[model samples]
Target: MELRTLGYFVAVADAGSVSAAAAVVHVTQPAISRQLRQLETELGLELFTRGPGRLSLTAAGQQFLPHARDVLHRADEARAAARTYAAGRLERLTIAAPTTTLTDVIAPFLATLTDDDPMPTVFESDPREAYPALRHGADLAIVTEAPRSTLAARALASLPVWAYVRDDHPWHGRDAVALHELVDETVLALTPSFRPRQILDTALARLGVPLDRVVDCSNPQVAQALAAAGRGVAVVTDDARFGLWPVQIVGRDGPLRIDLFAAWEPEHHAAETLAALAARLGEFCVERYGPDVAPAGHVGQMGREY
Candidate 1:
């Protein structure tokens, strides 16, 4: 099928109706509708079901959605690669990653860059949005999960998730606190959007530990601030702040951890160079954080939650 037809199909699916898709695609409603019909006929599958003023994907269409998106992404990658080829070399790169990663990890890494390295830009997004960020525009995605088999993904580091408390707090000088131990304490936590919070919630549910008093904040720094004020114990992956001591969060089997991964399209014109860049970044993380720091203050764990 034509790439244009696939584009129209995707547009319709995203916009939820033919007319809306037509507006997005800058085409007449009848033209786009005709294109969809022809696309379905060519594939021998009904892609969508009509409703009052909406269209929903059929079962087959649901299964095909990722494949369609992959094709479109590959096309975009090809165009980008071709442009890079025409330019003889890559000039810049964009990295997509979570806010803490950008702030604590990447910012320092950027300072170590040489004058010869491609100029880099950062996009703030969660690990779950890594691949989508790449499909949209980013050259690399730093995520908590290893990417799909199709893309090149390199494990960077598994960083520590700590329960931070001020010097005067009871747990401040302690080696570490068991996840179940948080049950009795007033706990400060980040929202579910962060991997540490997600890991904490899962471990709490699995361990049957219900925290009596929990304060959820959207920002890790804010969580730390609240903990420093004696409000609660802040559990986050960020570095120590507000003169607070960091304690490794011990889960049932091990410590709570956020695994970092760097991903990129393997077929890009500068794929090899990107792999080298990923390698450099991974090396830097290992050098800075060590392989598995899960033992005490800055430790790591084998079993990952995020």
Candidate 2:
């Protein structure tokens, strides 16, 4: 089927009704409905179940949804690639990143770009989804851990994890606390999808230290807020600006750390620009978090030929 038909199908799937889809696609309701009918006929499948107020996807439609989206994404990428090549230079850069990196790393790095430089677009997503968006078309993705992909990556920083407590709390003023020491404490944690939460969960599981209560948060700021309100012990990276007392999470060797990376497709036309951005990001992290947190030998390490 035509790519426009796939776009119509995806809009209907997202909107759940023809009238809504028409509004989104900037077409008349009858036009969208006719297109949907033709698409179903061409595929020889009933893609949707008609109803008075809303529409729902059929089993066949559910199976087809992801592929339709992929087709639309690739089509858009092809158009962008062609335009970039015709222009003989990159015109814009799209970077996907987790929220933490957006706040701590990317925002500052973006300020350093010259006005004539290609304007950067930032898409905030979960760390797990960021790299996929990059692979799909985003020029770069900054994530907390190494992604399981063939994309070229440059390590940026490695931040030590800490347990934050209110000044009035009993754990305040402590230099460090072993994993077992937190067994009976209610812990404020980032959501399980985040790399830090995964590491904390695995370490606690291995140490046989069952957390009394786990308060899940979306970002470090929220976790720190909860800790300051005496809700629970917030597990976070070292941030002196938050004003919370931080206790190092001592592991068998030493403090727990999480490495962050800037990743991009190796063959991207803007590889040199991406490498420059990665180096700038590394420097920004070092300036904000200190040299200890900056990954060793990360400078000038991007865009290595794969």
What TM-scores do the predictions have?
Answer: 0.67, 0.66
Best by TM-score: 1
Candidate 2 lDDT over residue span 201-230, tens digit each: 878777777787888998789899888888
Q: How far is candidate 1 from the true structure (C-alpha RMSD, Å)?
A: 15.2
184: Cα error in model 2, Å: 3.3
Ten-residue region with minimum lDDT total, candidate 2? 297-306
Per-residue C-alpha lDDT of model 1 across residues 162-215, encoded as one tens digit per residue: 999999988879878898889888889988877888889988888988888888
Clashes of 1: 4
**Model 2 compared with the native: what TM-score?**
0.66
